[model samples]
Target chain A: MTGSEVKKLFYMENKKGVLGKLKDGLLKTRRNLTERIEGVFGGRIDAQALEDMEEILITSDLGVKASKEIIGIIERTDPVNLRETLKGEIFNILKKGEASLLTNGHKPAVIMVVGVNGNGKTTTIGKLAKRFKDEGKEVLLVAGDTFRAAAIEQLSVWGERVGVKVVKHKSGADPGAVVFDAIQSEKAKGADVVIVDTAGRLHTKAPLMEELKKIKRVMDKELPGAPHEVLLVIDASTGQNAIEQARIFHEAIGVTGIVLTKLDGTAKGGIIIAIIRELEIPVKMIGIGEKIDDLRDFNAEEFTEALFE
Target chain B: MFEGLTNKLEGIFRKLRGRGILKEEDVLSALKEIRLALLEADVNFKVVKDFVERIKGRAIGQEILQSLTPGQQVIKVVHEELTSLMGESYKKTHLSPNPPTVLMLVGLQGSGKTTTAGKLANLFKKEGRQPLLVAADTQRPAAIEQLSLLSSQIGVNFYGTKDGDNPIRVCEDATHKAKREGFEPVIIDTAGRLHIDDALMDELKMVREKILPHEILLVADAMTGQDAVNIAQRFDEALNLTGIILTKMDGDARGGAAISMMAVTGKPIKLIGVGEKLDLLEPFHPNRMASRILGMGDVLSIIEKAEASIEKEEALRLEKKLGTDSFTLEDFRGQLKQMKKMGPLSQILDLIPGLGKFRSEINIDDRELIKVEAIIDSMTKKERGNYAIINGNRRKRIALGSGTMVTDVNRVLKQFIQVKKMMKAFSRRPMGGKGGLNIAREVMKWQ
Candidate 1:
């Protein structure tokens, strides 16, 4: 078989596996949300069942405002139609926020991954680098998280693991200079996509947010309208604070999308439901497991089906 | 976002206060508000239900009837319950009688095990105990290196092997090395994994068996939501965790997850990681966390409350006014109005400890403040802009116009110039991690 044919076969097989993995990855979340909702669900939603449904939705981390609104819309549906209506509501919200990661056209498409401490910013960058590299494109990783100890080493290790080059400076070096240098490098000129990994910072820290905004300004200075994608990597376990993180990060540095990570755990990333319903920021990708291949594009229809089915 | 639980309760109580007498419907309404605040704070619905029940049982009997402010009484009841439920007494983690006490740290992926391990070692080292940082986290690449580098930075010994596969073996060898080297405590930093990962869980159990550590701390994120209970229960059930260490406490998260895990797993939270710096780890104080959670009496919470009360735009405007040399009487008048809205001065002093001296020196009479504002209002725009332009005749005219003595007008003008000089100095200093009003509040607290 030719390389394209082999690629086709791999994609065909991986497509099924990807959906299954997405389902399996989100199995904990599905069990956490759908099964409980289904258990409390019935025709002619009783007061007790409605309250239980609301409780489950709130506890699932759907957030109070979103849960209240979702339950309000679902409770009005006819009996026996509740399940489908709930599914429809979620699908509509997820659908509005669904967008595939597309960095094909922009020269040196820069994707900057940012989040609070230990939200998988570096790992997500590594996975993205591998994904882009697998698509037969030159991928370059930038170690912009210069604060944490051995953060540059961690990115370089990912670079080696994925067979890519990493542009970095010493630890404690200014991240703006690092980003500027990375974009100016010859490797970046030839690379199709340059992924910049920022230091994990809580959005509440004004100085840290200012630093991120400064680095973002640097990106624009070097390449006008650069950092084509500012993906906020939020841990799935994060609750209501995800909204705060999303808002502050978006307000300060401008997040184009969210990469919800650690979904293989029980967390449903229900904060995304809150994020899209409130902020209108689409979730473009999700990190399911530790393996690099565990990363996948978010599918609204299939993800909704995973919970229902 | 996490300013106060009292605000939510107060809002509901305000609604209740509008009605003269409390009725059954009002009680139910109050419970609903408490329920929603806890839920939004990320408290588990089950725990919240129980807590609301307890509040109903405690707050309704004699408390509400005798209380002057029903809202304050209800907030007090909830605050007391939260503190008690979270375990009020603060105690350090009990060190084992034997030397080389092993501390095994575990948690979910990206939960800050490596950095927390380094912090634990640093904390123990600072306490005059030689602790060894064992890099048993072989899963994530460069994680061992990260810990090793931290060990170097902190001047602590580290143990790890290149074999990298068997975490149990690495932990075993590290303990033996710690024993030989006379390091008082061996902190085993385990790789973060999902609690449901049976294989990895089993591996962690084996490492636990091998080390037979005195403390198995589940390093959890303070920002964890409702699932904190489930995760904590699983780790507590699986490894029989001795204590819990909550990381990232410096964030704006209300840290309700601390309460959830404490209520469910019944494990003492040993330490809290306040910042990324290794030295930022401190012993967990439940009463303080309870206050921190409610945004009640804690110093940080009060400062944050002040920040929340002072609008960001107003702060920026104040910063701009201070930036230029033209901090006028108009800005000083604005500051007075802002400080009035910061809540009762006496109550603020009572809430913040170590301010007893300030309490005596700063006599904040609202009427006097109003008179001062009137004095400022009586000044002309040019005189307000350049207080230096104000003469004794203008001061006498201002006092007569504002219904105050000339001495009062002189005092107001003198205070405004001093405040201008102080604010200018603050604005000149670099703002490292604080905003405009926050820096102001910090200086006020110190003052």
Candidate 2:
């Protein structure tokens, strides 16, 4: 859907008093901008008007750097169609950051999922596994989050639903060891894909983070260039703080991409702009709902459109 | 004053102080503290990991400052960066140019949607706008009744269909009523599901189709931690929310929802429900909140308030006297009167950067200020300006006049001297060109 379509969706009128107030607020900002632009064009659109527009963007939580960049472009291009120009700029910002899920050249492509606990890392793994299996790839699920209770059971249940084999050890066992075994089994069984789930540890714990590094090292040793994707699962509801979490995880262990879970909840999903602007990391997938099928591949155009809509 | 977080921060800072600058080890240590704090505050673990990595990249290879303490500098940087990470501006709810602006509140059950509706109405009412409240949450038992009671208490008009009418119909009817009655703003409190159920989503979609709300605000409970983020994402996908209203912030909720929800849902946090009181609602200010979490008093904000509320000539005179060590009880009384113009002392304290955690503990009472004033009022003008004039007989007479014992007067005098001494010391210290002494200077000037 186009951003204009999403914008139109928000403009629909209802009797709900709370929704009406909120709609008025959003529309008022947009209307104020339109009026200001009209006024600027009627007279002389000077640097001060441009500055005012920049302030408006920044105040809207577009961040200072991004707002400056947008203003710079507007000043340079002097586009006649402000709305289209703004939409194009927003679309480009989102487009530059896209996370690709597919990988080639490695049979039974190994993907290691790492994140802090309760970030839906295991569930994301299950959903991804199901996605691959439904695409006709023989997938193997490894319950590497062995530190937490019921984690193995949780993955086992997902494996059963997805019709995939799960390799797991007792709780408190080495997560790295489980990944090592899962990869070996995948090769022997000729599985099309191998997804490893690692224990959720705070990035603050040096020892735990060191363990994740070791796990990646061991996986690479067993299968050259194995664990091709180190997807960092971040909760979408974290607003701008999620950017901080993403940066920390990327520094500790190179995060190939991001899985932004819980996109269904917050209005601050606009924070995706801030995250992409700062980290330059691709958002591979988004979890819009709890169902397995709800994990949709990140589409910048679609997401941007959803925001305006 | 944030006993729990302060101890954790102290541990982390102690380890980092020895390292000089923020190194990988320091980052690790600090992350550990932050991780524990976020978890204790009920933040999702995955979110914490990503958060730590971001801090690490910015912290490493940094030069250690020798003049200022390393711990203090690191804390300052961390706090500043965290605030920036959460978006630097305070986002206000969008208002349409056209009258009868629609705002829809969505969330799961027990997310405090009803209370938030009342709070939003109260906020608009304070701005002199007439807001109509609509009870669209027909699923939950007594949801409509609760909204009715809150609306009555807040003095806002409420519309709801009795006998179990459809929520969509209720919203449509309410909007028509609001337009007819010339209400400027309309707030709708919708039904919340226990989870992201299809039935709930479909019902919300129907309401959206019927009303076409300008903004869909998800009312989320901060205490739910990571689950709050998940629920927000669901509602955003189903309803396409315009913003978020975080509730139950008055509790020890670590505020993970504020961070996670913004990151996940890409929505701005429009308002926060700090207390159950209708007037306790505050617009979400990222910088102020960041400083509060870091334990630094928000002196800048307080100064801003003082600038707005305190008379310019009075403030300048007080500033001059404070700088010259000529401040006295007379100045103190003037400051107290000025503070009254700003609003409640408790509310002012809560705005201070690092003082949010200690807001409950801070003794800010009008009665206490009144007592202090009475004591000052009983003293002769000469005694008020130069506290040294009050001898034993004079002190006894002043105390009796103020309805207090001599000992209480003596205690006040002793505390005033200590405060004056502290100000003297603070003025001598370099403020690092950042107006660090603003709060102290302002307080002393008031005295």
Q: If chain B of candidate 1 is superposed on the true chain B, what is its TM-score?
A: 0.67
Docking outcome class, model 2: incorrect
Tell me the TM-score of model 2.
Answer: 0.48
lDDT score for residue A102 of model 1: 58
Docking class of 1: acceptable
- Per-model i-RMS: 7.7, 15.1
Name the top DockQ candidate: 1
Residues B174-229, model 1: lDDT tens digits: 87887787887898888888998888899888887777889899999989987898
Candidate 1 regions exceeding 4 Å error are: A1-16, B13-21, B62-73, B299-442, B445-447
lDDT score for residue A124 of model 1: 87
lDDT string, candidate 1, A1-309, tens digits:
132432242234345477888888988878777767767774358888888878877777998899999889977778688888888999999999999775767988989889999899898888888898898999999999898988898899889978999999999999999999999889999999999999999886666788998999999999998889999999999989889999999999889999999988877678898999999999999998777677889889877888777
The TM-scores of all predictions, comma-separated, are 0.80, 0.48
